[model samples]
Target: MEYGNPDFVKYAEAYGAFGHRVESAEGLAPLLEHGIKTPGVHVIDCPVDYSENDRILNQAFLRAFGSRRQAMQKVLFKPATGHGPDA
Candidate 1:
């Protein structure tokens, strides 16, 4: 381990789970809902390439659907509404 990262750093890194960062502004909708203020709960927005995402998603589909690429096509690609949860 480096000088900065000691033996305890590993444990800290494991415990410190990163927040579910979203790469899109439109995806901030559901986050504005209830229970958002709970401890350790966070939401962020950024940008990512859909094509690369598609490739990675395809692999995920393969795992989910036995290597079937069609599994990825049946996905809903849409942003979210920033309305409150009760809305």
Candidate 2:
């Protein structure tokens, strides 16, 4: 579950393509513009901090579908081994 982040820029260059890494927020727009304007398979490695994913995504989901969460759980927990209509 914990696959470490690889150097995507180097990986792209290994394949003989253009690669760029966004070092700061301000650099993103310019790098994106350059990549789009002139490109032959460009890869931009923009590191993102997802530390608040659980708080942001889970809480929003719970708020939106709180009443239907239990109902949805039944379908989600159902076995998937069946192979036919009668199985």
Candidate topping TM-score: 2
Per-residue CA lDDT of model 2 for 43-69, tens digit only, reads 999999889996787677667667457
lDDT computed for candidate 1? 0.53
Model 2 spans > 4 angstroms off: 65-87
Alpha-carbon shift of residue 53 in model 1 (angstroms): 1.0
- Per-residue C-alpha lDDT of model 1 across residues 19-51, encoded as one tens digit per residue: 444446766665545326556634342444567
TM-score for candidate 1, please give it: 0.24
Task: Spell out the clash pairs found in candidate 2.
Answer: none
Candidate maximizing lDDT:
2
Q: TM-scores of the models, in the given order?
A: 0.24, 0.60
